[model samples]
Target: MTDSENIKEIKKLGEEIMIGGVRFKSNVLMAPLAGYTCFPFRLMAERLGAGSAYTEMVSADALKYNDKATTKLLYTDAREKLKCVQLLGAVPTVFERAVKSDLIQKFDVIDINMGCPVPNVIKSGEGCSLMDDIPRASKIIESCKRSGKVVSVKCRIGMNPQRIVIEEFARMCESSGADMITVHGRTRNMMYDGEPLYEYIALAKRSVSIPVFANGGIDSKEKAEEMMEKTGADGVMLARYGFENPLAFSLLTGREINDTKLSLILEQIDIAEELFDELYVLTYIKKLASYFMKKQPGTKRYKLDLYKCGKVSELRELCTAIFGSDDNAGLV
Candidate 1:
C-alpha cells in the first residue's frame, strides 16, 4: 500500500477500538502528565486533534476520603469529548470505591495508573511498585471492572531492570478484565532517561488481546510512525512531549506545522483565560510560552521579561511585542 493508504489504515484502526462506546478520532492519545495535563492543557490537546486525553493520576485514597484539594484534580469541563480519568492507588477497596463514585462516571473511561514512578507513589505500593505484586494488581483490576466501567491500565515494563515482567503482568490484567492497556517501555529504575524499549512494548502487545498503546519517547511525527512500525501498538501516547508542543497531535496526523498552529496556540490561551481566572490563565500561558519559545529566534529577551511579569496584561504586552499584536495577522 502507498504511505497515505498505510496512514489511513492505522488511523482507522485507532478509531474502532472504543473504550466505552466513545470513538477516538485518531490513535494518537495525549498521555497524562502530572502538573501539565490539567483541564486547560487537555483542552488544548483535544483541539489540536488528539483522539483522546487522560487526566493526571488522581489518588484513589484522596478521592474516597473527599480530600478537597485532591478531588479538584478530577474536575473537568462538561463539554470535553472522550474524557478519561486516571486513578492511582494500590488499595483495591479505595480504588474500587473511587471508580464507582458518581463523580467519576461523568467521564468516558476510567484508567488505572500503574506507571508512575514518583517516590511518594512507589513507596505506597502504588504506581510501578504494583508490578512487584501481580496478585494484588489483578485484584484491583477485577474490582474496578466490577464497577461496570470500561477499565484500562497504564504501566511500565517492570519495577527495575532485574524485574522484567510486563508480558506476565499484561496477561493478568486482561484475564482480570481490563479492556485496554498502555505500556511505557521502561523499567521504573530507568525513569524517563533512556529511549523507550520498543521490543518490550511489542512483547506486551503480543501477549494481550486487548488494545495496547505504546507510550514514551515519542516527540515527533516521524518518531510516532516509527514506534507504530516497530511495536505494532494500537496507539501512541504523548506525555511531556505534548506539553512542549500542543500541536503535536495534528503534526503527527499529517497536518503541517505552520502559522496556523501558532495562531491556534494564541486562541487556546485566550480560551484558557476565559475558562479560568486571570491569575491561573497567566500562569498557564507563561508555562506554555516557555515551551513555545524554546527554539524561536529572538525569544530569549521576551521570555526573561515574561518571567518577571506579575499580571496578565504584562504577559499580553510581552506576547504582542514578540509574536505581533494584530489578532488578524498570524503570529510570525
Candidate 2:
C-alpha cells in the first residue's frame, strides 16, 4: 500500500461512528481480557485512544445470583467513555436476567462471549462450545437483545478445524438480533495457535450487514491495516496484544496520546488502590508491571522484585525506579 493509502486507512480507523445507536470517538476497541480489563485498565485504554473497551466476561448465573466478586468486576465511573460488558453463559433465561440486572443495565453495549476457548468454559457448554449448538446460541443473543442494549457477539470461525463456520455463525448472530459481531479468526481446536485465517474472517464480514470486528494476531498498525484489508472488517478487536500494550489503540491509530507505559502503570495503581484492598492492589500491579516491562532489558529481575513487594508502596517505588527514571519506556 502507498503511504497515502495507509494514512487514509488509519484515519478511517479512528473516525467516529454510530454503532447500535451509540456514538464512539473511534473504531479501534480494547477487547476484553480475563484477569485484566478491570475498570482502571478499561479507563486507561479509553483515555489512551480506544473508542470503547469491554469488561472481562461476567458469568450470567453469577450476575443473576448477585455474586459479589462478579459485581465488583463491573465497576466503572464517569471517567470511562463507553461502558460494555461481555457476558459468558449458555442458558438463554439466565442471560435474559443478567442483562436486565441492575449491575449490567448501565452499560452501553453487551458483547456475548461465544469465542472464549478456555477448557472450563467449553466444558460447561458455554463459549466456543455454543457454536456446536446454533439454536441455543441464537436464543441467548435474542434474550440479551430484549434488554434494549446494543448486543454483540465474539466468536471463533468454527468449533472443529476441519470445517469453518464464519459465514453461517455471523448470519445467525445478526439475525438473532446482534447489532454487531466479532469473528476471532481461529477454531476451538486451534486455540490461539497458527495464523488467523484471513479469508474466513472475510467471509463473515460479507455474510453480515452489521459491523464485523476481526480479532486475533493484530498487534500493530500494519497488522490492523492488513486485517481490515484482507477481511474487509469494519474494525479490529485487540485482545492479547491490547493488554500487553494498553496504548495499542493510540499506537494503531496514530493518535497522539502522551502516555508512557510507566505513566499508565502508575495511573492504574492509583485507580486500583481506591477500589481494592492493599494486597489486591499490590498483586495485580505486579502482574500488570510484567506486561508493561515485557521483553525489556532486566525485565526478569523487575518481575521478581515486583512479586516480592508486600506493600503497595513498595510496588509503586519499584515502578518509579524502573520506568520513571528511564523516561522514554514505550510511549504512545
- Using lDDT as the measure, which candidate wins? 2
Lowest lDDT 10-residue stretch of candidate 2: 2-11
Per-residue CA lDDT of model 1 for 1-332, tens digit only, reads: 43233332243323435654557777788887776677777776776778778898888777767665565567677668777888889989988788778668777778898988889888899998999999999999988888887888999999887899999999999999999899999999999989998888888887877888989988777788778877778888888777777667676665444544346556767777776777767777888777766656666777678888888777776766666634322322
Q: Give the TM-score of candidate 2.
A: 0.94
lDDT, each prediction: 0.78, 0.84
Q: Over 4 Å off in model 1, which ranges?
A: 1-16, 65-68, 255-262, 325-332
List TM-scores for all candidates, in order.
Answer: 0.88, 0.94
Residue lDDT tens for model 2, 1-332 = 43223322322567676789898778788898888888988998888788889999988888857776887899877888789999999999999988888898889899999988889999999999888889999999999999999998999999877767777888899899999888899999989888998878888877878888888998678888888887777888898788878777887767897878778888999999999989778877887787777756666766678777899888888998888756437842
